[model samples]
Target: MLEEDANAGYRRLFDDDGLTFGAGFPLTGTNRSTPPIEEELRLASHAESVGFDGLWARDVPTYWPKFGDAGQTFDPWVWLSQVAAHTDEVALGTASIVLTLRHPIHVAKSAASIDRLSDGRLVLGVASGDRDPEFPAFDVDRNERGQQFRERFEAIQALWREEYPELEGEWGRLEGDLDIVPKPTAETIPMLPTGQARQSREWIAEHGDGWLFYHLPERTLEDYVADWRDDAGEKPYAMAIRVDLADDPTAEPEPMHLGYRAGVEWYRDYFRRLEEYGVDHVIVGLESEDPEEALSRFGDEIIEV
Candidate 1:
């Protein structure tokens, strides 16, 4: 499908001029099994109301202690449905669903249903299983995640784009006699392969509707974008940034795992550089004592500027 065939969610991020931001999941900043669902929904509403472009959810089937992130402490489909019901205009997305651990038919149905429910506002970010424990929990082979991801992704695409596609894979087989119901609001849901997902860079560019990645250094990101252009041209490239904004608006960047602890001015200049590198969207995570206040500052100072 051409770029224009993408749903509203995809277009909101990629069809625009420069970069837009998405609020990351677990707004409460807890990795516990239970987070404040009502409050999180409240925060999610607050986020979109303040002009954040999208609401992102994560799919963590089972929380692994080693992973230390429960990813919103709810299912992506469920939480996003709640987000969709409460908000409008802003896109709804899965930071990623672990496809290797799910059947393609199920994923397709859930995606289509949510897409339809959200008024064509579902962007499905999919990934190979990575939490190690999840593979065994689902009786999946850890080593074969890459293959499973590729296969499931292909199956999902066919399921959406075709009426009765005949296919066979470890995930399942279709005889062309049955069909998955609730087709997407659009021709197909935009599928972004996240974190390499154990697939080659070439494969992702060739097959993915878009690409999702973790934070990279500025120089590294420049090289990555250069390579992405080689095959995918202007197809969107998105990433996650864990931010710890300093009180001083002029403080330079200080390193933190996948992002930075920097002043607002530094972030604005950084976003400009990212735009120059052809990075289309960023999933911004604010790590602060008061997430709501941080988001307020981000919307008023960082995103608005």
Candidate 2:
């Protein structure tokens, strides 16, 4: 298979020798059940002003109380479009949209629209549904999510790259009699699959434009990057880390959920290590009393170093 080159968003965010950073939405450390959405645009612009490369939005179609996280509390498409209007250079991304829950056609259309609106700065991270109750709520069979995920993935690709391409599978069929309009700014928008999405590593390596995974320890990250390189060649590798920045610049590393509670000095060294291990980009879920201060600190202290 011929691999597509990185889109503008990917190129801006990933380089051969260094790592780039992006901030996750709901930049404030607000309650999980009710994110402070009013702060998003201001912080998004602030992130760009401070030299962050991208801003990511989470796609939670429906909030499950049991899940305990509201994930930005807005539709990914609408949120990204709004973000795009307020910022010029920063890449806009979906941390991972639940592809299994949405129709592929809708995903394709919305993705393309965002790509055009943002002038090709959209990076789509997609995943199979992770919330169990969501499947029943959406009237989709949870058991077939793997198959549905594969089908939707292929369908979106076909819709983007082919002119009236013939496609047939679980999601439905495109018989080449019709076509989806407003193609992406590039040949296609970048699509990074999150955490295997029930597919084999081989499959993800073969199909995904890149790979997005949760935070792992240094040794595990090295192994994961090695395996990805062996199977996928030079595709980008990205991950998310939950960070609680301490006031002291030289604070020691401490464990947190999927990341660490550390200070700028530790974070700088940590990111340097990630760059050495071939991580291309990182999405940071920042924890701070004042998100603006945190974003400014990260850009000035860690990213500029």
**102-162, model 2: which lDDT tens digit per residue?**
9999999999999999988899999997999889999999989899999999899889999
Model 1 lDDT tens row, 165-208:
89999987999999998999888999999988998899999999
Off by over 4 Å in 2: 1-5, 31-34
Off by over 4 Å in 1: none
Residue 100, candidate 1: C-alpha displacement in angstroms = 0.3
Highest lDDT, which number? 1
TM-score of each: 0.97, 0.96
Best by TM-score: 1
Clash pairs, model 2 backbone: none
Span of 10 residues, lowest total lDDT, candidate 1:
1-10
